[model samples]
Target: MSSSRGGVQPLMRAAELEKMSLEQLKAVKEQADIEVNLLQDSLNNIRTATGRLEVASTALHDLSLRPQGKKMLVPLTASLYVPGTLDDADNVLVDIGTGYFVEKTMAEGKDYCDRKINLLKSNFDQLIEVASKKKTVADEAGAILQAKLKQLSPSS
Candidate 1:
């Protein structure tokens, strides 16, 4: 049967919903319960990840500002052709495998810096939109679940 409003079925009242067959009502209750639990878990995960992202952003800022000796700073300077540049030059090491200038182990520092920037942007967007939506869904699901539970136990 076609519904009148926006080609969709009208929402039912809590009292009206309790009149459905046991099997149909049971399925709806199960779905609502699952949605509530899933939304709660997702919110927890997003919170934890957001905290980590903040820490990572702070660390990246510190690293970017921190002074570095010759060797630790070479990876950030993209100009490979600059010869006899004395700034932080003593720390440069010749790679045994490739005979090219390589910063010992601090190369990963650049990677981490890039990762931190991207993560902050992406996660912030997700937390604002997806996480917020999930929270709304969980709230609605919680209401549906509560109504179903009360239907099953009318006196409570």
Candidate 2:
């Protein structure tokens, strides 16, 4: 009987669902559907972030192995790259967030990426659990609604 995100009411028992009017059941189903969709979007974003962090971590490791002044192609945009040389492989710029970048040593940069990846993974797991519960609620509501409609049909 625990509360769900966005102040959604707890999942009701089948008896309670059976007592509700069609409109009320529909409202419950719609709300649960919306919440589940939102959670799914969040989960996707977290997954993308984790993937980017993993890439960053791998790049950092690769860079650490290269000597200073190594030739490289710096990406200016998705389709554009500029030739450049690694001036200081030991120090790299890390984008913390919100247009803020910080200079960190290679080890620190790798650590930061690992930490962010772990954090995003943790959030992803928790959100998955919530999304599953919300989906169950929506499915149950839809099932009950269908049953009610069937009972009221002329063929019944």
Error of 1 at 138 (Å): 9.7
lDDT tens readout by residue for model 1, 69-106: 32343243434543232344223342323555556333
Clashing pairs in 1: 70-88
Please give, for residues 52-124, the per-residue lDDT of candidate 2 as tens digits: 8998899899999999889999877668999999999989999899989999999999999999999999999
- Candidate 1: lDDT over CA atoms? 0.48
Q: How many backbone clashes does candidate 2 have?
A: 0
